[model samples]
Target: MSRTAAQFKLRMPAALRAQVEQAAKEARRSLNAEIVLRLEASFAQVKQEVSQ
Candidate 1:
């Protein structure tokens, strides 16, 4: 298969979507970047918990 960044569709409540958009604007990141950053952080947190 050709190598490329994976793409997927997500559905969220309007309020949540607005919150993410505001955060992305403030952080100077695209909405996709914001979501990826959050996902990475969440996985790191889980790893830390398992290690403890």
Candidate 2:
């Protein structure tokens, strides 16, 4: 299946932003990609909980 990507703005605390950026760099991924991956994982977890 093809997915349509949409741009959205997220506000993060400065400290949290720095942590996320550090993690992204360590993983060799762009910050945007890292955030998307994290969001997808969170959504999956929520869906699983809702289904149970």
Candidate 3:
């Protein structure tokens, strides 16, 4: 899939930030990449639900 590059700011609760940091470390991904992957997955799930 082709990806569109963009930049944005997000504010998250401290606890959530910690979780993302941990996951990013474990996955060997940058924090930004981890957050983007999560957002894309969430969007895909919502799309599937709406289609159903």
TM-score of predicted structure 1: 0.89
Clashes of each: 0, 0, 0
Q: Tell me, what's the RMSD of every candidate?
A: 3.2, 3.2, 3.0
Q: How do the predictions measure up, each by TM-score?
A: 0.89, 0.77, 0.79
lDDT string for model 1 (1-52, tens) is: 2238888789999999999999999999989889889989999999999999
Cα lDDT tens digits for candidate 2, 11-44: 9899999999999999999898888889899999
Regions of candidate 3 where Cα sits further than 4 Å from its true position:
1-4
The weakest ten consecutive residues by lDDT in model 3 span 1-10
Candidate 1 off by > 4 Å: 1-3
What is the lDDT of every predicted structure here?
A: 0.90, 0.88, 0.91
TM-score, prediction 3:
0.79
Better of 1 and 2 by lDDT: 1
Residue 10's lDDT in candidate 2: 86
| Candidate 3 structure quality by residue, lDDT tens digits, 1-52 | 2257766688989999999999999999989889889999999999999999
